[model samples]
Target chain A: MQMDLVFVGWNHRVASLDLREKLSFTPERAREAMEGLFREKILTEGAVVSTCNRAEIYGLTDLDDSFEALASYFSRFHDVDGSVLRESALSGRGDVTVRHLFRVASGLDSMVLGEAQILGQIRDAHRRATEAGTARTVTHRLFQAALECGKKVRTRTALGTRPTSVPGIALSLVGRIFEEVADCRVLLLGAGETVELTARLLADDGVTRMSFCNRTQEKAAALAAEFGGTVVPWEERIPAFAAADVVLTATGATDPVIPGPEAKRALSKARRRGPLLVLDMAVPRDVDPAVEDVADVYRYDLDAFGELARANAAERQAEVPLAEAIVEESVEKFAAWLASLSMTEVVKQLRFKLEAIRRDELARSEPRLARLDPADREMVERLTEALLNKILHNPTVGLKHGDASQRLELAAAVRTLFKLDGEGRE
Target chain B: MASPSSPGLTNALLGVLALAAYALASVFYTAYLRHPRLKAGRLATGLAVLGAALNFSFLYARSLALKNVPYADLLGSMALFGFFLAGMNLVLEVRHHDRSLGPFLMPVSLLFLLLAFVLPAGGEKRPNLKGAIFAFHVTLNMLSYAAFAVAAALSGLYLVLGKKLKHRSKNVLAGPTARLPSLGYLERAARTSLGVGVVTLAAGLSMGFAWGYHVWRVDHPFWLLDAKIWGAGLTLLFYFVVLVRAHRGAAPVTTARLCIAGFVLVLLSYTAVNLFFSRIHSFT
Candidate 1:
């Protein structure tokens, strides 16, 4: 018999964000649902991994229809329509389930690709399942193997070394040029959404000196107050450019806000510390294209960001096969362990049969031995028990140590020799 | 006067091996610039270090075979300049942890080494009036030119990258400019080399003039009239102006251009003055 694992899930790749949101579960709800699974005997062991990008259930079960049961359970638990859930849900079993879990844990299956956050989510799901008493022997081992795989993939590869997002790539480029981002002054030319997002990422990178300028004083003030930065008046923005090491412009102006001559004149007064990096994220381009002509000014538009992000993403994607190979290796090891489990059952049954025969022989010979001394009877019993143990030892060792094919052959031989082939309880 | 001699077979063989090592390092460095692989960068630096060591041995062997130091003639002086440039790059790599400069600087030393073989090795014998001072002056002068060579390379990189940014080329953010150290960093590297060149050239020139005055007190004014003397002095004055301008907040582009001009003067002072106009110095 095979130790089958079933997996059912929806992820960003196959399902829309709306669908994932509808299918996602809170930690408390996921734990409660796992406990229900064990109580109802729907699964012997299972874990529910719910993250912003995906929701999946990994279960060890003997039932052939375990995938359908898991999907139905998820739909009911989340109060989502079963038809909609089934439309987007992916199902896998056996080694497929093991490999998927490993990939997810290693962050190969993450939406961002090689992001480290998914590992924490996987660990949380495992802990919750273990606490709810739903994750037993097989799932417990599976998750442990997955966590090890995650660590191995990270330590052995450069997958997570480069940044993959637009803001991340931009900041990384700045890091390459400048010795330190913390010393660089950033000027925000607009209070738009992209500006806000870029500001947050820059602040996270330790760029504390920031100046916000916008046509709307209130909006600029609000943004500046939020980040504890200075708010420059819209009129003084060009002069503010002189003090900035980086300028991020995303204004919705029809004409250029910073022309070549204007920016060059402003930079002439700037401190001669380093080159200035300007990111023109505006669609119409707030900074004049000719502004790049100004000496020591490095300008990049949104398209440049996209190009860099694509390159970084491509590099990360190249490492996916290596991570998948690791997953495959781990799955094979899991399959071997599962095979050994069946061997354990065969060995236990064979030992029990030998012991039962020994006891029966002793019981039948009791009257004949009653005439003998107590010591002689006791010695005869011990001698029969020892003989039985000696007979079972070789077969037990072979079942445990032999390869899969050899172990199966030996199991069948034991059953035939003991006449226990039809005993189906085990 | 001792006759000038070609480098011995062993010296020539070592020179060839060193050149091969540098050529290999240059290939690795170019690949590393594209990929930024740690292994490739390390291998390039390792090969460069090995090449420099072999180059040093080759120079020592040539000097021994010639019965004089290598800085006495054009070919040996060019070889010495190559050694200085390679040593400077190695120092920069170790101190800054930046191998991005290797692809630009390595080719220069390789050119100098190649020139060492192509140029005539024989030169006039010198009178032993001030041997120690002459050796000091020649070595310092060669090192100053090496420093200028480094400055010129940095300035060239600055102008090329600056031009790419000026054109707003789509590949500016993805091409060679993307892999370079910042314009600010390159400018600083250039200014640093320029400053070194100015100081060393000044010291070397003053030492040469003082030694000349000691040798021919009455004819010292004629020494001042020599083209090599004027060329060396003008080269010194040119870099001194650049250094001062850089200190007084000259634009980085202007400073970079000035460094390039200073290196031109360096080339003229060493090559054109020695070859055509200088009556005292012998062609090598």
Candidate 2:
């Protein structure tokens, strides 16, 4: 039976982040687990990819019946029920496996549509597999080509430049409004990781005055101290609206914290001074949308940022054809290298067949050439050599033109034609 | 003298047919507004599309007969406006998969088509650089108006949906009517239309100013005081402010309301020239 490359797992499209996290293996754990699989003789070769978004197992197996065992092993390793794992796991064989890996590495299968993070995650997976000593020639070559294709796609296209996340889009709008962030005073309404990331990004943009206002002032103070910013009391948030040039509200409030009337009054005060940029980043917005009716007060919510993000994503999507072309070029190169792996067996069989014909002919001619001189016998040897060369020439030519399927057929034909099976009759 | 093979017959017939169809469709839409039944709403949408298709066929036939651009005069412009409104409603219905907007859009289209029937036709074709640029300019303006009409309709729907979602806390409308794309979608549509409108308006204004300069050779451009130009300019400034605020991520619902306001200005600009003043674009 022919060896086949297979990929089995779940990713962001089918499973959520919480489910993926439950299934994920740490890098060290993945190595130990893969090594254990090899020690158990369950897989000849295997690799584990565990990212925040997905956990995939790619393997090359000589035995076709080993899939059930591998699936069972995966279920056991993740402590997930066999039925649940089977439902979430995607398995691709042969060419489909190659295509799936390439698509994944190209970020075509990502949750955020065209995010660039998956390529790095794939690279990390490859590194872990190599260190685990489970990555064979086929898996190594395939992953290397996949990584190169990802790099080419990113550099040749605008896919990476577009913002897909809410915070990223808000920052893009901020860049449009402010010439420089140096004098900008940003007020963050929540102190979660998303808010911290937004604050850090704003700080990197040279934002000087960054204040964190959370329900708990101590938690706010801790985050504020870490980012070299101050903490504002939640009670004073309404009155502090004037000091905030860019107000970002992403609190866990069910009701709007900044109501329409208060925002209108604040806007009237701010207009006497300057414009105030408000970003209501919460799911259930923290600020009333009616606040925008007040002149010089600009406000945005999650859905608004999503539109801008989609538009930016659309602009980047224009470069998809270029990225696809790069991936196609890499697929061809990988296919050619994979096809060349059978050449050694073909060469050995050819040599053996030629020598067998030589020996047989010499035996048949021994009686006829017994009366000939030593010099004449030497001429007969040269004639035999030429005959063998001419006979092997067409087979050699056919072997070089053959692809993987044809190569496999040719290898089988050579072994049968020469009777070079386990019996070893040259 | 007008050419014997001119588009007189086709334009008159299409004008009458479009007006009649729009009037019928408007009644159906109004019925939908009163009853708000699913079946009635579907029937109204169907009638609206049928009216739009007739208007579309009329435009095509007129364009073929005129051997020039179809929407060239006030009658043609009004017919085109009806077509625009109907087409906009058709798209909204399909996209939102709801026919709640049929009531508002059908009457507006019917009014335009009815006005088209009464507007004077057969005005002498003015030949000049301004008249040449006028067709392209007005076509773009009408296209922008069509987009704004859809934006304005969606804005009104957003207000109703926003109120329903807020007060009733019912997610039933959220799937169809309230699922009217995020306020951002409507705002972007408005901003884009306004952007295109501003450019076309600028082009039309510049062409008029140039033509006036050639004819009168005065330091004071006559188009500067033209009511149509001034109205369009004011509308342009209103949208510019909307776009600027929208760029800062202004609340989508409020921006949608602002877009409705912008569309009102557009309507006023279109009518103020035809009803109140004689300008470069005045067909009569």
Candidate 3:
């Protein structure tokens, strides 16, 4: 049987943002559509990977018309013009499709190169397909290997270590300064978007003891309520700052909010054991630059963070070749696994054929051997079994390790030499 | 019972096998340094474990051939040192779930094995020092040396990473840097190794004194003034000072420097005194 693996999709690179949004599917809808294709026999095995930036259907099919059928069904289900859908999306088959899935799972095909979220997205897609009863041996192996490739790319290369966004830069900085973020108390000094975003990142990094301060108390309160935290008043900022493990400043103030002397005096009063990590994200510089002179205080302004992001991005970009090599290696491995499936089938038949011959010869020769002692007859039986095993060992090993055409030719020869049918039965 | 070859031949074969295994592990570890993968780490650990096992076998076979514990010889002791280093690193890798130190550690292990190749397989034809106390002293002393070796390697790593962080070097947090455990973890490992080293060395030295008092009589305890004894004493005291500094919350860099200096002292005690100076303990 020929298993044609295919992927049909549009991603952020190929499609407009509006088109990608229009083509996206809810998890439930994606699963339902995948099950529908499996039910219709257009896809023998299928999974739908849908996100805000991309929507893809990966499936195994035996029919030549599978891709066209999948494309038509996609357009009809979403009520899009067939020509427009074709123009916006691309479909690939065979190894090309397999390579694409590997790259996608490895984050090489993400909107941001080496973004981590796509791995989870692909895993969820596999889980959904498994639940929908639309995944089988080929697609399951492909998806599992893709996930493994994704993890290998992430851990083996430096692809995912670089921060691609501002919030990511902040977290990377925090990771550099502190070994563990769970015990850190965060002091957010503004209620603007950057502060809110950084707070969310910090919370994700396990920063629980968080308090926000703003010129407008209501904004601070609103932001604090969103993060399940309390608000700190402007007057109480010094005490909060001193108590905080990390202080993030992103305010619209034109002047320095936390002066050098004030920070030093607050730090001296607090008498903290660990270093204080300060991120000054404000454009006009909310934290005074001279605060860096204080003991046990590491400060980074916007320019420093920008520099970190740029350097890390360059590092990550340089790792793309390594990640791609991993992807290519995974694709070849998957192909080998697929080929081995056919080899397994061939070997099974060959074993059946050889066993039949052994049984026939044993039936014919047992009576003469039976005249000896029962133990002697049993010895003869063992002798012939060993002989068969030795005879079949080399060819079976060869077939299992052989390429497709070699396997086919050797399988045909084995059948013909034994006068067995293609099924390896007499 | 028939044997394929002499016990000496068998021991030499096992040594060659162990060297090959350790070299293979070193290659894998070095590869893992550039490409941090669980597979490479697992393979390196497996090979290191294999090498340690073969190394132990070689030591046992050599002891059987010589009709004594192998510690009397420089070659045997160095082989034991390599085994202990790999074995300790395997334990640390399992305990801390960290593999970044392997690339840095395997070379030291390989160096010891290479030394084993050149040193005479048997020590000088001295009578076997009686008493289990003698055995305990040598074993514990060798074990302490292994612990200090690990401490020194981790301290060196601490310094390199500290330098990178101090200067904010480009790509400091990428590639091999990403593979390294936090400086906190390295420091903890170094401190733990130092603690173990100090305790073992103290017990070992005490056992040595007791063994000497029994063997040579209390009136003839001139080995106490020997270069090896002084070297071992100062090495123990040096690591003890590092332990105290660590307890007092000395900076990681300072503790690292102290551990390094302690290892240097250990090197002097293990090598220089044995080769260059005459002493009652010059059995190797």
Candidate 4:
């Protein structure tokens, strides 16, 4: 009833990899440590989410120093100086704790913004704590609600819709240029690793017809065989520009493979009506910069593509307010549920007191009641239980349904009237 | 008959209610497009459908009072045109499973309904010709015009979206361009609407000519000189060419531009020709 939430964590934004690795907990070790935490009485409930990018400890505590104790516990368990833990990471209290966990679970606070893996990590952490018997009502509900919030944010907002990685950026660029990737013919130059990775991603995004061109035709043939495409001879790679709707070049050649003038002449000769999107992904740039000046030919080199990635990140950032709104809604809901826990305690105690009285009255009247048949006696027991439930029904409903502040008043009144637990229990 | 206590029971009140619904739907759809998190798209679709229903009620009231198809007058035809627009858009929106076009398309119907209000009521002109053929001709033409209106809306959006995509604009959330369909989708949808418009216009124009052959004398001095007749012929020709080009998979931008031009011809045919200088036609 007197629980308060606290969080102690360090992420890539604040701590170096060395510190994060030092502070991280394995699943088996986390459970063992959480049981020790229960014995130490620092937290009533706790969960530890330890991943490559972050190590977070979430808990319900009643002591004023539980946050400090968590920091100290981390240093002691990991054999680091307590001051180093304090200096590198900070703790969040109550609402801040809830908000931090929600943001992390929703992928808003991830190293790669809007990455979807954090939600599963949080779920696993909560599960481990539950299996360890260290996660009770509040910890379980908080994580469950956070997971729901994470899902809603993913679905209802387009925060995670933008691509951030290199292959993802290539997919997004293709999507923006071509309305239907399934209909476009993709030409992947240089059967290198970058091109292979991009080809696989593009294939998954519905690029069916692919043509691979490499100086080493065998490498091109191998990649084409793997991704179900044909390999064009290296001599015919320039003419292949006229045939391709999209051209992605990532060759390690020290020079431009498709020169701007040659591409312009070839594209002009073909008189292609639609756009020719060329992504020059090589370090030295596979396609010459002048190809962009050609009419209806859109070209972006590696740096220009990085600009696209940055712009995509900015767009994802713009959706933060929307994601934050969802997180805010979940936090308010958790707060209300937490407040209702107090009322729940009153209801539990009131029922316990009523049941005790019921048993005592039945015991005191045992001789008189023992004269009834076994069936009648059983019916009497059921009747008393039903009567007790009926008496509790309205007050319980009234306590649960109203606003939190009003419910607090009703809970207080119930506590005082029932005289079960006084205000001193507050 | 709907009772007077009902909101849109009276013809005048029905026009007002339908117009109001269309107006609110426009705002909601626009809001939904700009900020999809607002969750206004469904409500906007519902309002548009309600507006269409009210427009149908208006037509039903006119039909009940006059025992006709309710397109005999300028006002009645305008209301019917708006009704068909909303009706066809609802069909397309549901069919495509994309509600983003509502904001762009609803205002056309709203404009027609507003024009209906400013004009005289249905009783101003009773049915001049009362045969099934004549009714089919008028109704088909109105429905064809409605389809063209939808095609025009989709084409306009296609042009804007295609331009934004071609330019590779990152401001996907800015202005009215947000939530616009992909260029391919818009092109395909516009072509579909244009195709329906052409087929319906072909049928309706044929019916008109057949009925006119019986109704109006072929040897009349000014029969071929009717501005509406020339307008209809020109619009049909231009749109038929656009449809052919689109069917052949022309560049989407060219197809979008041609569809837009075709809609311009349709507007001229529907408005300038219908309202002003058509000697043999006085349709609005």
Q: Which ten contiguous residues of candidate 1 chain A have the minimum total lDDT? A: A400-409
Error of 1 at B82 (Å): 1.5
DockQ each candidate and list the results: 0.19, 0.02, 0.16, 0.22
Error of 4 at B111 (Å): 1.1
Q: Where does candidate 1 chain B have its weakest 10-residue lDDT segment?
A: B167-176
Higher TM-score: candidate 3 or 4? 4
**Candidate no. 2 TM-score:** 0.48
Tens-place lDDT per residue, model 2, A258-330, is 8889867766555332346788889799998887666445677877766666666675677677677777777
Fnat for each predicted structure, in order: 0.22, 0.00, 0.15, 0.13
lDDT tens per residue, model 1, B80-197: 8888988998998898888888898887888888877776555446654337787788778888999999999889988887776555544445534567876667887888888888
Per-residue lDDT over B1-284 for candidate 4, one digit per residue giving the tens place of the 0 to 100 score? 22221224477677788899999988888788777745588889989999999889888877777676676666677888999988887898898787788887788789888877675332224235668888888898898888888888887887776556445565433334545666556766778888898998989999888777777765455666778888998888888988897676466677777777787887778777777787667652
Ordered by TM-score, highest first, the candidates read 1, 4, 3, 2
The native-contact fraction of candidate 2 is: 0.00
Which regions of candidate 3 are displaced past 4 Å? A1-10, A18-50, A55-106, A122-163, A169-191, A205-426, B1-17, B37-40, B65-68, B73-76, B116-129, B212-230, B273-284
**Model 1 lDDT per residue over A248-358, tens place:** 999999888887788788777666656778888888888876766666677888887777667667767888888788878888988766554566666776777778888
User: What lDDT would candidate 2 get against the real structure?
Assistant: 0.70
Clash number for every model? 0, 1, 0, 0
Q: What is the lDDT of residue B151 in candidate 1?
A: 91
Pairs that clash in candidate 4: none
Candidate 2 docks at the CAPRI level of incorrect
